[model samples]
Target chain A: MAEITLDQIIQPENMVYTRSRIMTDTVLHYCPGCGHGTVHRLLAEVIEELDLQSETIGITPVGCSVLMYNYMDIDMQEAAHGRAPALATAIKRLMSEKFVFTYQGDGDLAAIGTAETIHACNRGENITILFINNGIYGMTGGQMAPTTLPDMKASTCPYGRDVQMMGNPLKITDIVATLPGSYYVTRQSVHTPGNVRKAKKAIRKAVEYQKRNQGTCFVEIVSNCNSGWKMTPVDANQWLEENMLPFYPLGDLKVPEE
Target chain B: MGELRLMKGNEAVAEAAIRAGADGYFGYPITPQSEVMEYLMAEKPHERTGMVVLQAESELAAINMVYGGAACGKKVMTSSSSPGISLMQEGISYIAGAELPCLLVNVVRGGPGLGTIQPAQSDYFQSVKGGGHGDYRLITLAPASVQEMSDFVRLGFELAFKYRNPAMILSDGAIGQMMEKVELFDPVPRSKEILPWATTGKTPDRERNIITSLDLDPKRQEDFNLKLQKKYREIEEKEVRFEKIQCDDAEYLFVAYGTSSRVVQKAVQLARSRGIRVGLFRPITLWPFPSKEIFAMTEQVKGILSVEMSAGQMVEDIRLAVKGKIKVDYYGRMGGIIPTPDEVVEMLEKKIIGG
Candidate 1:
């Protein structure tokens, strides 16, 4: 019990973990073990690692993470539901030097904001789009989303989504990948430490391409909404691995020339 | 003195936007007001003043683009006709709620749905009362002449940023498509002043800026609304703009705005020739509605006629303004029809004078 003082132990070389300064002290409203907190942390870490803290602007969507601005210590704009890409287009064009990104959820991006997402991508706007696909509308109490898997259960579709009646789940990332304006497009997840590292690298590289003004760089994070999914946090991750991964597989859908 | 040129109202507005040092214009092509983006594209203002003019995919995207640009405290704007404006309501509400400064121009066309492309004042209620959700108001300016169409571009931005609210030039297709001589100001350079609340990027020196209308708490949202209403009252007090012609000696008054006001001005002359002492009250600012000024005219005139291109949207405001102190009557032509000055005078006689 020799007093090992705090200052002596918290040396730079010994520091293995610390919250990114890019993230504000505000507690994330995300449910415990919800992927949003992890994704938000990754985004803040990416921005911090890239040293774009002062030159970055984040556009948040209208889902569970609409309040993402409260946690990220960066200039931000909260867009109308699904219109984050359109907003990002304008912000990036007017302030081309600023690193701009839009973080959206499935309903906001793949459904109501589909046109904005497609057109912004098609125009080759130099902005990054971070999409969170949770298979259900998490904020509105687990209503069905465009990405809700067929036969999946939701509050609005409690009987489980019937493909014929509810329509097939949209593969917006795949559709976006085909667009020439998409210089880099990828699908990722943050359920595991290994996956988290991969997702962060995707975000960093996407921002890099945006800095070059290459075109639209999109990163779709296949995440879990345990609260909306009506499952425990652990079960949600296991379910995401079994059901979500097969449909929305995690991989680079599009990549610039080697 | 500025450069004088004969230009369409829409074109004049476009050129004036460049001269006003607007940072960007995002628009979609639509009848009557398509010339705005067309002119911007053809002129290549990007080369002229480094202005960013983009043809957005749709009115929805266009207004959102304005939202994004305006949140950064940039001088940005968008133009559309009635149907297109309807599509922008969602974004407009968000902009109003965020209290971001921006300009909008509605070159109105007749509409209940996909109505005619011809000029109409039917959007009067939409612009003033608001076509969007919530208790919000846009500082609306109605330009009777192409000069005002051009001039309002600058004035609209000034008022918008002054109160950090949206300003709209509520013109009709007639003024948007019609041509008239306009005196254009010299091109000013883009503003270099920092907007402390803008989301341009967070500097290490200060806290991050967030632009949003979301206040999950009812009390906080209510307080924000009360603050908004207070600003609106200030605007109503200081920004109500109008012009009175021959009102000092008038026994009757005509209250109108935009294209209808232009025709009503002529009707005033026609009514005067017929031994009727009538004056024209033209509201330049529509949302502040010129209510008090029009109400005060009740003491001078025996009656008021609210002429418009719709069945009678603005007449309701006049009725409220005059408060039954005098007869408040209405005459209008619907579906792209413009009433003749002679016909307008006759109706005034039958409606306000005798009724």
Candidate 2:
């Protein structure tokens, strides 16, 4: 067989895919098969597709992806725990021409930073909020979060979450969708190739809303935490589909009226 | 001076921020400092200069907003009273640690816990001694009059940007609420140049800028801390500001600042009338405090009395400054009580002269 030359294989017609140009060469710190790496790539792809790589300012929450800037070649600010929305609020307000978005986890958005989250959405700030709900506090060793499923066992709820004591898991995205300030609210996942494509489309749409000054765009990605879930990556996806989706079903919660 | 008007100290701060070309002002309403936001809203600088003025839901949100604004290389500020300032300590610490430049004004009321709405200087220790959870220093300015309140807004931004650290105006309820004549400086047009260190979206020309305080690596964190300390040391050497009144012929000294300094001036007058040779020394910068200058006064004075609205917070710094070479005594009223000129003189005569 003839040798496949590097130049020949790299031809545009032969190139099936390439990593997003906005993503840096830095190594990701996520565990193998973790959904964070996938979602990050999706966001990078969206930024590149819209040619906003130089005009986007990202706000990262104080969770596992606190170092999101390390992987993204974009101007970024690391916000305090649950304070990403507050930071995004100011950044978007101060620089209305730039695209600003916050990446927050379930604990940050639904638990510690409830007030910041709710108010930013209610104010209808022109920004995007990307929420990743893994049900448990992944960075803090699996502590149960406000979005932890009922009866789910976590580090803090080792005996399983008792409905009487821990109360019901919060449906924060639904609550956010109800806020008039939010121009678009959607929920998607990246556990599979099909899901990844949908999630990317959702992110691009959210960024479009921000560009139009249409108010806050909240996109919640129900993701997996194999390490925090104490399951293998394959089993975690299976478990998420069978268990997590039943409580936090995925789809657009709110859409712009035609 | 471009404009002359009668204004409350808090109002002066707001007006100065706009005139100084501040990029944003985020704050929540609190007594003794509510006028800061009220005045900003009324002026609508957003319409005039494109500056953002947001009334945040809480002090916590306001300060964090300041962090974000500062991270973007914008001139940002927030004002609050004692309890509100306490709620903002966490955000302030993060800003300090992140090396972001911003301004803060604490129009202080009395408080261990929501003590009173009246003036007090009890936050002296909290302001100077790293109130939040880290070993960082805030460049603190003590504004004495409505003019200084207006003036420090610009000066604070200069110092904050010069060091890439947070600067605070340590004020009190009396100064914040009292109305007096203020000469405002002409507006400084906001600059369009993008700072190299700011987190204002990356261009194809530069490496992306990041605004963060977290350093998981121990060695790098220590180096940053050392760098911060070095900056503070330089500030202490270069920015010590103090005003000495009649100290050339003084035998006794009355040391004070902020609202207390205003009263101590009259007390100095009263003491001199009684043929007591006493002068006043007012510290303008509280963190890069007038320590060396106060120590210099020990050679020309016999005894020193420190007057404040707090029980004795600033006096300890005075003791550290004088280094026990002279007798440094403290006298003040607390729980939002203002000291009278006569009572201050009596304490001076008793605490230092007699003791």
Q: Determine the backbone clash count of candidate 2.
A: 0
Flag clash pairs in model 2.
none
TM-score for all models, in order of appearance = 0.98, 0.98
Name the lDDT value of residue B347 in candidate 1.
92
Worst 10 residues of 2 chain A by lDDT: A207-216
Per-model TM-score (chain A alone): 0.96, 0.96
Tens-place lDDT digits, model 2, residues B38-145: 999999998889899999989999999999999999999999999999999999999999999999999999989978999999999999998898999999999999
Q: lDDT per residue, candidate 2, A8-29, as tens digits?
A: 8888999878889888999999
Q: Residue by residue across A1-258, what tens digits does model 1's lDDT show?
A: 899999999899999988898889999899989999998888888888889988998899999999999999999999999999989999998989999999999999999999999999998999999999999999889999999999999999999999999899999999999998989999999998999999999988998888788899999999999999989999999999999999999999999996
- Output the number of the DockQ-best candidate: 1
- How much lDDT does each candidate structure score? 0.94, 0.93
Which CAPRI level is candidate 1? high
Q: What local lDDT does model 1 show for residue B79?
A: 97
TM-score of chain B of 2: 0.99
Q: Candidate 2: list runs displaced more than 4 Å.
A: A1-13
